[model samples]
Each structure stands twice: as structure tokens, then as C-alpha cells.
Target: MRQNRHITSNVGDGASGAVAAPPARPADQERTNSPGLALGAKAAGLPIAGLAALLSARIVTDELGLAGYALFALITTLPALLPLGDLGAGAALLDAVAADDGSPRARAHTRGTLISGARMLNLAGAAVAATGLVLAGTGTHTWLLGTAATPSAGACVAVAGVLIGCTLPLGLGASALAAIDRYHVALLLQAAGSAAGFGLVVVAAGLDAHAAVYCAGPLAGQCAAGAAALALAARALGMPMLRTVAASVRPGQQGTRIMHLAGPMTVIYTTSALTYGTDRLVLGHTTSAAAVAVYSAGAQLYRPAAALLSSAALPLWGRYVQRRGAGGGTPRGELARLVAWFAGAALVVGGGLVACGPPVADWMLHGEAPVGPGLMAAFGLLILVHAVNHPVGMWLSDAPGLRFQARGAVAMTAVSLALSVPLAIALGPAGPVLASALAFAVCVAVPCHRRAFRHG
Candidate 1:
């Protein structure tokens, strides 16, 4: 199949002095490229996912108490840090597919190679993660995150490795869908996966299952959903699953190009995982699981808000790529409008949470968890910061600005690591949030935005 091409025409006077008609765009292409429709789909999907997540967290915290909740958080966090074994291939796939200026056969070849590479890498990562977890499980009573190195902990880690392995392909599938202008389908699949995971967690909490059982519910849901999504994407793309997998085994230039993008992205994302993941782990080690629980609960407010901002900006990525490919200038007005809207919405949501979080947390935890005013404030601020900065970050995702953004990520990571430990010791649970907010604003947000505009 040939990629869609837009043709242009110039009007000229004929020998008969007649005007020529301008070329028309294909109807299918027009619909597929509609930014408003794409943005609407993403906006619709994210809230449903966010709501499921919030409900799941509330149910788990209520049923399991702080320590159990902390354990749950740790299980989820560890897998997120593992990079799905592809060294950022998921992101690389998205970038590659979006920026591809090649024949359909070439695109298919690239996708296959990336898919194959990601699977192999995931398998390797899973092995390493399982080994590390098994070692940790056997060596000491308390492993990282203050979880007892019981058989269950090891089992949870193993399950997390599996989840990470599964997530990589699903993410690539979503990217493929987006590449084909199926933004709604991609977002829907993601939302459905998150909802499935949430439902499983809720069921486990209701059954009062073992820690490993509870952890397994979400992991299984994620893996299952990812597989389903990948199947759907393959069918939509008109690609045979086995053939694509087979193609992936052979090395190609497309694969090399993907790795080139993935390399820097891997560094940036690793730093991000550390910045977010290490906070709870540090708290668990220095303080207690209960402290981690309180912090996690407070931090939960940030996710939905951030998701909202992200969903709103997600469609802009394709637009940015399209504009850049066409050698057009950045749409400053559109970006500013989005940033302003996101800031307003964030403030409203953050303010509401600040006012109601303490009461809500008290009710949800049944007084087992404390959501103090200070923690709420910090969490609220974090949400606001993330919301405001989201557009800036999205703008920087363009190829020209990615290097600056990566540098910003590194700086932010360093600052977070430096401040998180001491502040956690001094101020307890509120410390990490404070450190993240400060570091993100000073290091990541500031420099990225500055460079993004300069490049723009």
C-alpha cells in the first residue's frame, strides 16, 4: 500500500484564458488528520482511565491499610522503572512511525524490527529483574521499599517483570495506531487497559487476597489488555502478526534509526523513573511503609491531573511533527491557548483537592492514613506545576528540541536525588513532593521552555 500524498496545484492562464482548478485533498486524509477530533478522543479516554485509577486506589487504601497500600505502590513502581527491556523502544517506535517518510514496505519493516527488538529486550530485562528480585528475596528480611523479602515479594517482582515485558508491545501497538491516525483507538485501548487493571485490584481488595494475589491482579490485567490491544492494532494495520514477528528478527537500517532515537530517550526516561520511583523507596528505607503509604496516597492526586493535561496535549504531537515536516513555523498561539487552558483547569482541580483531600483521605483510609494540610498543599502544588508545564514539555518533543529536553530531564533527576534524601529525613512524607516540585520547576520546566521557544 502506498502512503497518502497531498498534491498541490498552481493556477495559470490557459491559451483560451481559462483558470485551472486547485487540487483536492482526499476525503479520508482530511478526516484522519483532524486535530480537533483526535484531541477530543484523547480527552474522552483519559478521564475514564483516571477515574478508574482513583477508585482503585481508594478501595485498596481503605481495605488494606497503609502498609499494604505501600506494598502495592512499590510493586507498581518497580516495573515502571525497568524500561520494558527495550531501552525506550516504545517511545522510539512512536517517534519513528510519526516521522517516517518512507514506503509502506519500509514502514512495515521498521515496525517489525522494532517489535522484535523490543520483545527480545523485554525477555532479557525480565530475566535480570527476576534474578535481582530473587536475590533480594533470599538475602535479607527487608528488601527495597521496606517490603519483607518473603516468597510473595519475590513472586510479585517476577510478576512485575512479566508485566513490563507485556507493556512494551502494547505501547508499541498504541504508537502504531497513532501513526495510522487512529488516535481515538489508541487512547481507548489505553483507557480500557487501565480500567481492567483497576477492576482487578478492586476485586482482589474485596476478596482480601494475599499481597502477591493483589499485585498480580493489576499486572495480569495490564498484560491481557496489552495483548488484546496489540492484536487489534495488527488487524487494523493489515499486517499479519506472525509475519511481522518474523520480519523483526532481521536487522535493518530502520532498526538502527530507532535505536538512535531510543538511546537518548532511554537516558531521559531512566532519570524520570528514578526521580519518581526512588522517592517512595527512599521513604520506605529511611522511615517506614506507613510513611510511604501516606505519601503515596497524597501523591495519587497528581496522576489524574497530570493525565488530563497530557491527554489534552497528546494530539499536538502529531501536529507539531506535521508542521515541522512541512517546514512551517510553530503555532505559538495554539500552544499558548492550550497552556493557559491547562493552567486554569489544573488550578481548579488542584484547589478542590487541597480543600477536600484531607476529609476524603480520612474517610477513605478510615483514619488509618493521615492526609495533613501540608501534604495536601504540596501535592496540590505538584499537580499545578505538572499541568502548567505539560504543554511546554509537549512542545519540546519535536526533534529539534529533544536534546535540550533530555538535558533538562538529567538536571531535574540530579536535583531530585540530591534533595529527596535529606528533606525526607528532615520533614518526613511531605519532603519528596516538595523536592520534586522544586526540582522540576527549576531544572526541567525552566530550561526546556526556554529552549523550546528559542528553537521555535
Candidate 2:
């Protein structure tokens, strides 16, 4: 996030149009281009798929009675296995392909690496799912969350397994697609799959299929989506279903380099996941289901705003990288600008949420749901705190001191784990939210942000 130019000339030399802004550099402002438009539209499309997810959550809560919490918890936790899935290798593949943009060999190499990566991730995910089942069977499911049902408790482990398995490949594909800038196509496939999956759940609910059959439709739909993504990737790059890593390739060197970069990145991703996911799952277990529902609804509404800030920050990240550690004379001025923009936008969004929260909650939870007002306010506070800290985290990502980011994540996770029980005991659901906000601001926001401008 760096910018400095002859604004006077670009603004028309104090003439009638003097205030007009100059266009940005290609690398820095690629978001202004057609490709950027496609990507933004694709990202925007997430809300639609998210809508389907909300619907699915609602139906599951309303009809099947939250049978999939154990499944969701299990699947989400499995992403912690990110280190083994060639998460770093995928990043390397994308960078290599982009560097060799004109080479056919690069495309083939990337495709092969991606396929290998996907397989690795799928295997790891399967192992996690299996572990979950074993835990459930052995009465050790509480490690997953206190909510996991025992095997004989009649929870649908099989259906959950299938759903978790199907989404794994698609998750890999989505990451691969994002790395390569094929965002629009990925978004469409994700949306279609989510919609189809949710529709199936609705139908199953209507027909009153097997007690746990609700998870079946979503699993099947995700599998189809994964297949479609594979086909699209193959067709776009003229590659095939690669079963193995290429014999001629030197994975030890290439994959290692990829992993080195992705190692911290994977941790970064996983820590962020844990920071929030732990709170949700833990809250679900320790508190009422209705409280979980209310918290989730508030989060769901707040997310789009956070996402938009991230979107705005994306181009600036590239710009910051191009500046090569300088913040364009002001030494991190660009980063600060991006952060300010995000903060301003977040405040507006958060305020709007606070204002309309009751009505919004009522609609989301179905009718005048009679949920807690304090819960809604606490949830909004969580999002706003997240907004402030998130950009600091992003700015930290491009710094040479990025390792600090990983440490921050670990700290945040530690705090989340440490405080989850006590806060739940003391203040119930709101306690976790309070703990999360405090941890992020302390462990992440304050220190890294200071570092961003320290030497500039």
C-alpha cells in the first residue's frame, strides 16, 4: 500500500478539472481494469452463496435441529492440517505460473502441482473426518467441541463425513483459482453448488427424509461442484486429471520453496480461522443453541462489510509490494490510507448495523425472534474490532517482519482458548466475544501497526 505521484499534472494543473485524480499504475491499480472487475464481481457473488448457507443453517436449525454442528466443527478444524496439504506448494505453483505467463510448460507444471496439492489436502481432510468419527465412537468427541454426539447417540456421522469429503477438493480448487486470478468462474461454481446443496436440504426437509439426511444433499452438491471445477481448470489450461506428481519435476526443491512461503501463510489462515471458529463452536456447546443462532446471524450480516474493506485493501497490498518496503515518502502512508479507508467504512457499516440490528435480526432469525439486544450489540462490536485489526494484519503480511503476524495469530488463539471457558462461565456468549476483541486488539492490532511505520 504505497502511492506518490505528480498529482498536479494528473489533476489538470489547477484548471477546471484540477481536482480530478490521476489513474493508478497497472500493477498497483489493476483493480480498475476488466480483470479486476471480474474478480470483484466474483467476490461480491459470495454474499449470494452465503445467503444459501444462511438458508441451509436456518433449515437445519428449524427442521433437522442442528444435527450438523459436530460435522461443521470437525470439517472446520481439519483445515488445521493445512501444513500437510501443500498449502505452500499451491502458492508457489501460482507464482511460478504467473511468472511464466507465456509458457505452456508452466501451465502444465502448475496443473500437475495443483493436482498433487489437491490430492494431499483431500487425504488429510479424510483423515480428519475419520478421526472425528473415531472420537465420536470412543466418547472423546468433546475434543472436537462438547457438542459432538456419540456414535450411538444417533448423530449422522456418515452424512457429515460425505459432506466434509466433498467440500475438501472444492476448497483446494477455490484456493488454486484465487491464486491464478480466475475468481469469477470459481465464484459461479461455488454459488451454484451452494444453492443446489441448500435446495436439496430444503427438499429433504420437506419430504422428511432420514433423520440425518439433511447433510446428504449438501455433500452431493459439493462433490458435483468439485468435479465441475476440475473440468474447468483442465479445459482452461489444456491439462488432464493428473494422478501423480511428474517424475521429471524436482518436488524437493520447488515444493519446499513453495511450502516455506505458504507455511507461515497457512498458519496465518488457520489461526484466523481458529480465532473465530473456536468462539462459535465453543459458544454453541457452552450456551443455548438460540444464542449461537443469534450470534451467527449478526456475524453473517457484518461479514459483507468486512469483506468489502478487504476488497478495497487488495490492490493496495500489491502496491505496497511494488514499493519494495517503502511507503512512498511518508513511509507506510499508503498502508495507513488503506487502513483509514477500511476503518471509516467499517464504522459506517457497524453503525448502520447497530441502528438496524433489531429489525435485521428479526428478519434473519425469522419474524420478531425475541432475541437478546445485548447479543446483537456485542456482535457488532466484534465486527468493528475485527475491521480495525484486520488491515493491520494485512499490512503486516507484506512486511519482512511478517513472522510477527504468525506469532500474533498464535497469541490470539492462545487467548481465545484461555478465555473461552471462563468468559463462557462468567458472561455466557458475550464473554467469548469480549475475549476475542481484546485478544485481537492486544496481540495483533497495536504492535504490528506500530511496526508498520516504525522505520518509515
Candidate 3:
């Protein structure tokens, strides 16, 4: 939940550009890449997804109580930590497809990227599942969150691990849709999944199911959505997006092309996870498990809101990539638009949440861990910092851009690690938020904006 939602936006971020003449829009994608269908769907779906997330949080809090809510948060938030869970292979495919020229060779490259990336994701999934089982066997899962170990905790972690494993590759469907300018299509499907997950959680909680079983609701919805999205993309494009599951694609390329981009991306994701995604751990170990829950009260709203804000701007990344490929970079006007939308969105959403979140959280949390304006404001500040960096971050999401961000991210991680513990100790729930925000704003947002201007 503490993941840098801005950076994660790149993985599935980007919308199709205007329907005007341009070399940026792939000849084949013209029909599906229209702005209305892509962005409109997202604009509509964002609310449902956000609502589902909020309702799910209420369900968890009411049924699971404080401990259950904390566990649920950890399980759901773990995916944000494993940034390289896909081995960055899916991103490689996105770049390939986005930069394609509608030639047979371009199609071939996209195919190769998908097949190879899928192979890597499959392996990564197995490894994660095995590691989860090992952790369960060793009885270390319960102690991971700085809490005492117990049999049930171990079992829960193990189950969470296996579920995460299956989800790793399934996420490629969404990634594929993004590459082809159907990001909004994936977003709509994802919203449906979130809504479905909410229904499942409600039913399960009412039936007295284990908290763990219902936590899987969201995961299952996401998995189904991903698979369905990928299948749709594959059928539309005639690409073997699903062939990686059964080794149907020949294994001749050795997958180096796919790894070419994934390697550096994984490094960036690693640094990002270390620098920004460790919020819960910092609180859990440095403060207490209860502190983690307190943070989630505000974070439950902050994370999704921040992510949606970035996502709304994500299509700009794809547009920039395609435009640059055609020797037409983004307009200065486009930059201004991003700055306005994200900043304004952050202001409105953050303020509204601060004003109203407390009452809603009280109802949702049942007073497990108190939520006040201070915590809400800290996350709001983080969202503002995210707004500052999001536009430039879009331009810097390519291979060379990843390399640049990776260097700064390493330094930011150092600063975050040095200060996160102390801040958590001092500020309770808001300390890490400040530390992360400060480090990113100084070390990341500033330099990236400068670089982007120079690139312009």
C-alpha cells in the first residue's frame, strides 16, 4: 500500500492519443485507440473501483477487527512490494507493441516479447509459491510483520503467497491492453472485478467465512479480469498472449530481447520498492502492528486515489512514446495539462478525503486505530508530490529514462531507509509518509523534471 503509485503507473499507464493524423498511432490501433473509448471508460470506471475498494475496507474492518484488518492490508499490499514479480518482461512487451510499425517484423517482435516474458513470469510465480511454502514450513510467516508467530498466521501467509504467484502472470493481460491503447478497456474490466470482489467479501463476511477467504475476493476478481482482458487483446491482435502458459510458443529467442528492458526496469522497481513501498514494514517493526492499521485508515483512501490520479495521466506516457517514435515529441501544452489535472485532482480529492474520511473511516474501522486529519494530510502531501513527478515520470518510463530514474531512486532509497525508521518512531503513522515524500520530491521529482525539460 505504501508503493509509489506514480511509478507503478507506467506498468499499465497510457491512453491513446487524439484521432488526428500522426505517425504515433499505430495503423492497426487506430480504431481501438480512440480517446473517448479509452479515456471515457477509465473516467467512468475509476469511481466504481474506488467505491469497491472503500466498501471492501469497511467489510474487512467490521468483520476482521483490528488484527484482521492489518493482516488483510498486508496481504493485499504485498504485490506492491514485489515490483519485479513479472520480471519486467511485461513492460518489455508493452514497449515493443507501442513502438511497432504494423509490419510483419513488428508483429514478430511483439510475439517474441510476449512469449519470452510469459515464460519468465511463470518461473517467477513458481518461485514465489515455493518461497511462500518454505516460509510457512519454517513458521517465519507470522513473525514477518514484527508480530509474534502463530500457526494460523503462517497458513495465511502461505495462502497469500500462492495467490500472489498465480496473479503475477495474469496481470500481463492488462499490460497487453495498455500497449495496444486499450488501457481503458482493462480499467473497466478491473473495475468490474473490484465490484465483484466487494460482493464476494460481503457475502463471505455475512456467512462467517474466514477473513483470509474473503481477502482473496479482490485477488480472484483481478485475476479473472486480467485473463479476460488478455484473451480479448489476443483475439483482436492474433497474438499468442496466452501461449506462454503451455509452452505453445517456440523457445528459440533465449528471451534476451524481452529481458533487455526488463533488466533495468527491475532495478528501478527494486529501488522504488525499497525506497517507497516499505511503509508498512517500517511502521510494523519501528512502531507497532497497530500503527500499521492506523496508517491504512488513511492510506486505504490515499493509495487508490493517488494511483487513479497517476493512471488518469498514464495514457500520456504512451502518447509521448509513440509521438517521439514518429519524431514528434509531446507539446509544451500537454505538459501544462498534466500539471493542472493532477495538481487540481490532488487538491480536490485530498481535501475532500481529509474533510470526510474521518467519519467514514470511523464507520469502516469501528475505532480499531484512530484516524485523524494529521495522518490524512501527510498522505495528501505525498499525493501532491506524486502529482509533481507524474508528468515527467511518464516521459522517463522508457529504457533510457529507466536508467536515469534508477540512479536517483537508489539515492532516494538510501535517504528513505536512513530516515524512515526514525520518522516512524517519532511521527507514528505520518513519519514515513513525510520521509518518503521529501526524498522523492527532492531526489526524484526535481531532477526528472529538469531532464524532461532538457529533453524537450
| Candidate that scores best on TM-score | 3
Ranking by lDDT: 3, 1, 2
**Which digits, one per residue and each the tens of the lDDT, describe model 3 over residues 212-297?**
67767887777778788877776555544565444523445334376557877777778777776688888888777778887877
Best by lDDT: 3
Relative to the unseen true structure, what is the C-alpha lDDT of residue 6 in candidate 1, on a scale of 0 to 100? Answer: 18
Off by over 4 Å in 3: 1-39, 148-151, 248-256
**How do the residues 53-168 of candidate 1 rate in per-residue lDDT, one tens digit apiece?**
56776676666655666777777656555533346565555565555554545454445455555555555544755665574457542455464233456666666656665565
Backbone clashes in model 1: 0
Q: Candidate 2, 26: how far from true, in Å?
A: 7.5
Clashes of each: 0, 1, 3
* Candidate 2 wrongly placed segments (more than 4 Å): 1-47, 65-116, 142-155, 216-230, 238-256, 303-305, 311-331, 363-369, 389-401
CA RMSD for every model? 7.9, 9.9, 6.9
Candidate 1 residue 412 Cα shift, in angstroms, is 1.0
If scored against the real structure, what TM-score would every candidate get?
Answer: 0.82, 0.74, 0.88
Q: What TM-score does structure 2 among the candidates reach?
A: 0.74
